[model samples]
Target: MMIYTPKAGNAPNDAFLFNVKERSDRLMNYFLMVYFVLGLIFALFYGTWLIAVLVGSLSLIAYYSTKLALPNSTMYQYVLSAVFGIFMAQFIYQMHGMFEMHFFAFIGGVLLITYQKWRLQIPMVIVVILHHALFSYLQNSGMDKIYFSQLYNFDVRTFVIHVTLASVLFYICGLWAYQLKKYNELHLSQTLQMAELQKESLLLLQREQYNEERSTILESIGDAFFAVDKDWVVTYWNQMAEKILSKPKSQMLNSNFWDNFDNSTNSISYQKYKKAVETNQSVHFQDYYEPLDNWYDVSAYPSEKGLSVYFKDITERKRTELLLIESEKKYSDLFQLSPLPKWVFDVETLRFLDVNTAAIEHYGYTKEEFMGMTIRDIRPVEEVPKLEADLAKQLNKDELTKRSNFWHKKKNGELIEVDVQSRDLVYKSKKARLIIANDITEKQRYIKAIEEQNDRLREISWIQSHIVRAPLARILGLVPLIENPAESLDEKEKMLEYMLQSARDLDDVIKNITEKTTITQNFV
Candidate 1:
């Protein structure tokens, strides 16, 4: 029911005005053409070709003049009104005051209303009054040539009455035209306002829909969210906020923010919120709330309206992080206190990242020096190629652990063999391997000595079993021959000589055992 008023100088209304002017111009041209045709018909009825030609020429001029004038100009409307009046007057003169021709003046007045300019009708009214009074007076004063009617006597009273009546009728037509113009203008203004109102209503509806969708999205998020105005009055509280804060939205809305959460004033959460609002910036932090006995990751965003806060419970995550840190500390202690040499090195560059106390003592290098050096620096020069190949194989393998026996050089230039146990893991967020080296140089040397001792022992046992036994068996054979009484003295002497040979063989075996034992002792 409201009457919508457009803004001043609205461009759409300006365009509407131009359109109305153009349409009025076209209508005026059409009416002038019709009026010219009517003038022609009247001339033909009266056999006045001059009048018809004059009227046609004037009509053409008026039509083109109006067309040439700017549509926005009121001058064209006035010119058009005058042209219509002149054409009608010419038709009336040719018809000699015919009532039908008189009616043409009223029609012209009505047609002028299409221009929607009330002042334009004044020209037509003036032309009608002048035409009727002057022509009637001339005809009554015996001016026969200009007489338009011969059927009635031309008396002064009669002429006055006729002119007066015609004047009143013309005035009435002019009044109607004026009222019509006013109505058209009002209608055009109202139509333009109605269209603008409809467009604004549609825009408002779309804005409301967008806000509703945004609200739904905010409500659906898992994080607790709330908004406060510049006055610190709560304006919005999502469902998650209600659940996390243990308060309903009905109690939160329009409530003072500090009144609801008084304990938070001295806390980091409140400080961050205040800072964000004061600086008009976004703040993100994690803090523990004593009231809830929980940690929260909070973010505050400031806007012209005020501040909005989003928070989520992070107590579980914090506890897990603490446990992980403790576990890493225990593992670090074990690694550093281990008796065997241990180190961590980058997988890509093979540079040592960390080393235990045992590694520093065994490798004869300071921890700082080890950190600046690569794993290859500790290996003997001759084994570097094999080390590179093994490293390449390890890179291609998905296995977590690898073992290899590598000869390493110490800081004193002493080469020691080591059994390396390497396990792959992430160290300081980088791909790296942890190496535990078991120094096996002494063990390998002892193993070799034991092997040599076993060989010597086997050789001694073989000599005692084969060579010693053969000599003893000969001796036993000779003793039996020498002890026999039935045998002759020469036979006994020969047996004694055989016994002496066997004894010599046994002595040589004993000397061989003594010499081998001495050599084995020296080797040991």
Candidate 2:
């Protein structure tokens, strides 16, 4: 969520005019300084102290004016200042009689034209030419006596020398200005070109940054994103797209996506993307997958040149859905084929809602008949109270044990024993009991038979002890009776001893049987 703003905008002004102003300011300062020094030399040598003072005052004013006007002023202002400076220099050279006027005029004329004032030099040149011609004529016509009488006036040659020198300075300064102006224009042109190039570079950088930001945003998402041309060539591939598709941008870019990837064949993404490109319309589809059990929800949006696609992985969702479908099928099969009777009851109403096939057979009721019955309705009237108490206990407890039995009556009016297990568990988001019961009728009969057989065995043991012991007691008495005094005394004694031992053995057998019957009754 961070935003970066680039400092890439047009400059405040054009490059050309800025350079012109800068060059003009520099030239003006130089001219003012030269003018000041040359004016001082002239005043000292020619004794023209007042003229030097005037020149000094002008130079000072020009210096300050140049500084103040530099930012806003044009080349025309510097040309005017250079002209004034040339005049002062002319006055100085003229006092020496050197005749440097032509040279100075030529320089000034060239400079002025260079400063972009090519037209202004004509009038100044004509004035200087006329003054020089008149001075030569005056000297030729004997104006020398006038110079001696005129207190402040010079001779004809001196006037000619001064005018010529001033003209030369004018042309020289003009030429220099002209050259400088040309150079400045060229430099400004180069600078403007460079600025344009810089501007272009900045624009490119901004475009790159914008693309990078868009890429970062797209890649940061968990979904896969890509774009393709009408030709099915890959153009854009985001980071998530790379990871999900298992291909990098370098390998995928410009490649035919449909041809390169095996999953593309018959896949919803490929179909939608291709359709968008073919028809130039947006397309969306879900439940797309690779062979690896991965599912995707895909969308393709048509653009001017191609299509943009977004893909979301739904593999886990699809797997869960499949598992639920299989589970439902298994439950349905089990409901129809299960051997035990099972009933679904509503916790709130305690009414029977659904029953399996075995429940109908065991309960001797039709599916419709069972639908109208509740747990209380199915129980025998005599057992209703006990069943209610057991049900309440089951509701309070977490689980139900199968040992708790319910007496259910058949439609034939015969009561049957059923081992029932019921627990309070959530069914369809409501508290309900899943009751699974099995008919334990045959098992109860076998248990009763076993108990009767055990009783008969105990009766037989009692008879063996009492009835058989009576006969053995009689035989032992007979043995004592059979012992005769006519026989040896040892024989009579032995027979009596054997009778005592037989009676003791019979008593021990009776005690063992009685103890066993007591232990068996305690277990029961």
Candidate 2 C-alpha lDDT tens digits along 470-505: 748765676745655577777777776777777777
TM per candidate: 0.53, 0.35
Clashing pairs in 1: none
Q: lDDT scores for all predictions?
A: 0.82, 0.68
Candidate 1 wrongly placed segments (more than 4 Å): 1-206, 395-401, 456-516
Best by TM-score: 1
The per-candidate count of clashes, in order, stands at: 0, 33
What's the CA RMSD for each of the models? 14.4, 21.0
